[model samples]
Target: MTPKRLHLILLAFATTSWVRADLATNLVAYWDFEGTADNHSSASGGAAYHGTLVGNAAVTGGTALAGTGSLVLDGDGDYLDVATIVDVNQAWTASAWYRPDLAPAGTARMMVFETSGNNSFAISFGLRESGNPASTNHQTVVDTTPTNDLFGNRDIADTLTAETWNHVALAFTPATATVAGSVVTYINGLVSQTLVIPAGSTLIIPDSGFHVGTYRNADGRWFDGSIDEVAIWNRTLSRNDVTELYERGAASLGLTADLAAAGKAFVSVESSDPALGETFGTGLYDLNESVLIEAVPKDGSLFTGWSAPFGAEPDFFNLTVTASVTLTAGFAQDTADPDADGLTNYQEIVLYFTDPDLADTDSDQISDGDEVLESLTNPLVSQLNAVNWIAANLGGGTEPGDIVLTRDSGTNTLSFKLKIDSSETLQSWGPLLPAATSSSGVAAGLIAVSFPPPWVDKGFFRVVGEAP
Candidate 1:
């Protein structure tokens, strides 16, 4: 083959693979009750291909069975059989929408039994054995829980609602051993509680036909209501998927043709096509939406009404600016300086921890007045720049004998005086004092030393003069 043709074929395959990655499998089973109308035999109703519902059981809602059905299993011989096509030993979820009638005496049970022994796993809802006739006891149990009294031994009670179509889901996981482990029940898309199953036990009864509506051997406790949209999955569904089912199911019942557009599949014992009655397949399950970023504040403050982004697609929402706005370089005093020079009280407190009231905050050994005069460092505890002052004044070309510093111990003051010899050039003087020394001194009798500022403490003067 030509190189051009081979490259084109490879590109086409790559494109197809990318498209297939976005698609997910759809699993749906539809059971429409419109075939050979049989009364008791499996042949009477549409090919007992899936199972059977006995005793005054017939599909209702529409003529062709495209709508709803009432599977009334109340009397001694009323039940529905769900034929086992696949082994459900792994994680699975079963859900249904049911509406029951208020019975007079006995409680109701929803059983899933095996074809052989009556000891198959089951869950029931109704009044407790000790419950008064007036109140109800909504109990849920597994096969491990004793079924001797049928109504007394249950893992959970007071969870079922009656006389209305309620969405019920049971999720099973094999790994968990706690009561909340193996099983979880959901009512109306919300998780109700975790169910406890027997250790080393599987909920799916092996080699047994899955039965619904009535207990295995017990009588008088039958589901006398309409069961629609019964679905079973090989895996537990996420919370989002459950919510989608509730919304789509409600929309479908409301006679919306675009109901599947809500991104969920509908499963039921009644099929839309007679040929597909026993078969389950995938349906509408794709809802692709884009996610956008949301902006938020960053002002280092607490936000009260903060909410995350939400929609059909992923969304990014902006958070209120909670970042701290640091006042960097705005203060008058330098943070690197231990003492603040000519700064206000607020600046001293914010920048350097110097006593804004006194010029020499730290009573080191030099006054603030002499520190400025001899080009010495400030003696404030925070602003004492002794190391930088010594490096600048003493380490340079300035002779050590030219600078002088005097401290009066009694008056607690310091005076810094610097005098230059007549022979010294003015250009050489510039290197000795980088700038003019603010002190009362005579520099070659030309530049007079004016006292810049006097401080109270003598020890606060950080400058000492070297004798000439």
Candidate 2:
């Protein structure tokens, strides 16, 4: 059958169960600093600069602007803004990978900012004491600087690699207590430190225009080295949350590059390569975090295009298999071939399907022909309770006339054998059969039979026919 036509439901008879899955988004933005060759200007007069691809990791063989580019390679201010787009008063986050040729002194190298007065805020990385340009001492600085207590600072003089790329991220929560609603910084994938403002700190700036590359104040420390994969989020990110961002950039970071585009919550920035890169802007707001973007496989489903090791579970639920039967099917006659391949019709119905002639239906293991003759319920069809019930009743009787049932773990099937004794009459046998057993001729003595080894496990078999 076509992959679309097969479906099956395998009931796992287990006391405990679990399924595995993952939840998160991998956002991509201008990676490798590749930008558009032509400068795109916003209505506010800010020019969008294109980054030129550099290094050996070009998207194309001969240095296509797809990966590895020099920032400001065109000499025009590779600056972009989100002042008109982002809601400044709400919580947000901004991050990037920057390698500056010159230490930003006396000025804020704005990664993301807005111009509105009451709702505006900015995130920058630079020297803590901006006045000393010649001094090598620098700190990972945030906020608008001393003008507001919102500044979260970390000393980075020892961490700065002059010409190498460094991953940086900042998460902001506006207007709340300093510690509760503030910014967090991550260097590489780890949180370097956290800054908190006291409850009544004066660093609140409600609205303002946001700028990237060079701060709007124009103190003149233009971002000289390459800036790649800049992103902005409308919500604050926790320390654990920032770790996710670091992971998304791990691929690029290993190559000394960033993802080719900005992903969700991404707005604007300057990079060395635009074509080899990508960045997100306004579209990120549409994603739903609660829903799973990927699909999972269900039990008894046919798995087409499945490749070896064969034992692993299917990755998705796109294919179908035979319809599942329930414990209610116990009353029906054995519809499957018995002893053809050493399987009973009841076993085949439990394991594969009602059609006994078909051997290895799904072709995974345990022959369909064999499953039929055993009278064992299909492991996929029988519920956990049913399996437990069979296990509990396997060998409880004392007299030779008592019935015994067992399960085969290797084949996952159930088996049964009846016992009759000279003392027991035929009338006693009537009560044991799955169906009503009536007296015939003279009452013969009962015989005793013992269940097999594999079927002894409490996990394997269940009663099908009534006592006879």
Candidate 3:
């Protein structure tokens, strides 16, 4: 009997038509915060722009929208002081994934820029919960001089979901003494508001201190939440660029900008027991996305393991889609006898070529386990001659019961018959007849052979094979 096999093959596919030029063209600084509070930027001749974590700020795992960790902050005094990375009075773009745990009482600053004096102006990007000086929830304040400042439009509340990650971006262009500039705000990669910079305003450089998660002076405006994938660009980003960042996430910026930017990776999932349940995370994904793969077994099936490619770590679920790969999850039925036969389902399918779902696979009255274990006969073929003999002769039959062969009826030229072997005390055995002489009357169906009473009483007989 050969073992029953089940194989499932699923193909994964994906396509995108959005064209992109350069996503990392002007990236000045970046912080993924994947277990560290360091900048991952290559700006200023590959210089490092690191920060020191202030009070109650920590990097925690499994909270990032794209990576393994995110920077968690408390509303008391948590902030990151990353000196100066961007020059003031120049075009710039800033973006991050933000999720606030609590609504701000007054203002919750996400990032702040300031000069090196006590009475100086500061540029701030934050959220305002209450309409203190303005009703708008999202704000980007640009301070031009010691006396004049530009505030965002006092519009409706931005309707942010609490504790849910959202992509936010701000692009600004400074105004010259004779020319007007503009500041734009984006929520989830879409432009939400735009404010025009009035002419005759002086451009002040905030090149002294830059901080994340607090106001410039740290006057109790600390951001109380998580921030991940913080990045800045030296130039204003187009609408398409922000949309791409929101769709593909921050980790894909450099990967998608490479010359050999592999477009998409697909994950093909399969299961050994498809009748139990379907699998997840089986589709085309961005080349830099992390996907979770899993399968849900039904009530009686047990998840055994995964097949090749992931066989080394069968229980590992998360996979980064760096390339196309196929995965197969294995499952086993827990029951021993699903059809209620005496034989275990494993023996019925693996040891004997019989259906586990059917106790009598050959449609004979005898069960499959009884045919193999007790009668010593093929469970896949009905024991027709033995069944007929038992029906007619009752208890007086002496017919050798287990031999079965299939051929055209009454075909005398088949050249095959049951070769019987005898063993005394169940040990040494030998063929009852010489090798040259087979059992007589080797025709097609319903043929019964019987030995003499003395021979039967002397030893046990077994059908070995069909020999000519």
Candidate 4:
């Protein structure tokens, strides 16, 4: 009997299998109950096969995983028969939302379709018992072909709460010369179980008629629940693809970008002017919208760069949400002295201790680069370029042999040095002081070394590091 249909919305692209118009390239059949029991999916040349609502099953509201309504199965004999959608079956993926009415029993109560003859594929959900290792209940079952040979019926163990909604996905990948084919099942986008096909065993996807809410060629085994968003894809879907559906509902699934980041930096993004903090993530964004993606660097590091999203230049931070993209950011450290100067970049920039770019920042007619690279002397002091300053310049001041630094001179380990460019704006300070001399706490002080040496440029001095 043809049951009267009610309000339903056609959701051709929002099948929970893929996102957007590009995803429709491989859709074989989509059973979105859009106001009727017809296939709401498109086909080659405007010819689409609609299903026959047999028995007392009718379309109703508030039971949809997506769109407006869903087909309710009465557990009596209600089922929808659909003709063969794809010929020459290969790798295929199917996703659906089923709401079971009660606890499933030993009876392989079919929730969907499977032909009972040769060249037929079976899809069902049951409380399987016979050969389960863990003795787990509720299985998502798939049989590649009804020929029933050495290979068939790959049962993916699962559990379903009665009267609640569940998202189920079945995927099969064809074997290649290098890799073996396998059947993977997902409950809510997480791989519930995986069954690997043995080597040399060629798996075949049957091309035959299938039905929803009943067993094929059998009078009974009617699905006692509702089914919605029954979609089929010609190709296999990855784990991320399933997760995209699970995280975002069918209404927000299609044509979204799976955004990600890696190494030293994170991302800050937003759309419609909402403020999103700078951080890395594995998130999805809708398509055909403008998205802000900015790279943020860490402490003591600079944002090395950005990759052009949506074919823009590296300088462009705004990205138009179009495709699934991974934006990677790079960061650099303060230790990287780009100019090959004597002082480290941190000492020059952070501490203002010396010039990072210029070897002769003070420009006292002697470059620190020339002192270190040419004369091989220490650039920290005015001129005494000894690696160990405590022994060499203990009393070598400019007064023809005045004590530059004396042991126990000023109640501390004392070290003095001339500063070049004392104009504050163009000034560069002396380098890091050498290790103190006496371990017994030297109170060294310089006794007013005969009036500082007359200099052409203003020279400043600093006393640093008290002896402990």
Scored by lDDT, the top model is 3
Per-residue accuracy of model 3 over 116-219 as CA lDDT, tens digit each: 32434345667665223233266666666533665622442477666677777778887777888777878876788787777766545654556778766766
For each candidate, give its TM-score against the true structure: 0.44, 0.37, 0.47, 0.48
Which candidate would rank higher by lDDT, 2 or 4?
4
Ranking by TM-score: 4, 3, 1, 2
In model 1, how large is the Cα lDDT of residue 378? 49
Per-residue accuracy of model 1 over 7-26 as CA lDDT, tens digit each: 99998875443121111122
Question: Candidate 3, clashing residue pairs?
Answer: none
Count of steric clashes across candidates, in order: 45, 94, 0, 13
Shift of residue 365 alpha carbon in model 1, Å: 33
Worst 10 residues of 3 by lDDT: 9-18
What local lDDT score does residue 123 receive in model 2, on the 0 to 100 scale? Answer: 48
* Model 2: per-residue Cα lDDT at residue 186: 71
- lDDT comparing candidate 3 with the true structure: 0.62
lDDT against the true structure, per candidate, is: 0.43, 0.40, 0.62, 0.52
Please, what's the RMSD in Å of model 2?
Answer: 19.5
Model 4, span 1-468: residue lDDT tens: 223222222233223222222334466777666566554453321345577788877767536665567878777788777666554236777777777766432134455555333434545544343122134354555554323443434455465555666777777776555676676878876888776645444533444566677655647766767777667777786565565555544442321212322111112221211121133333455455555555554333455454333224342356555555445454454676655655456555544455677655544333555555554444555543332344354446555534554444232234434321123333543222224443445323212233565643433333443322
Model 1, stretches more than 4 Å misplaced?
1-49, 61-66, 104-116, 122-134, 144-152, 155-161, 176-181, 196-201, 204-206, 218-220, 253-468
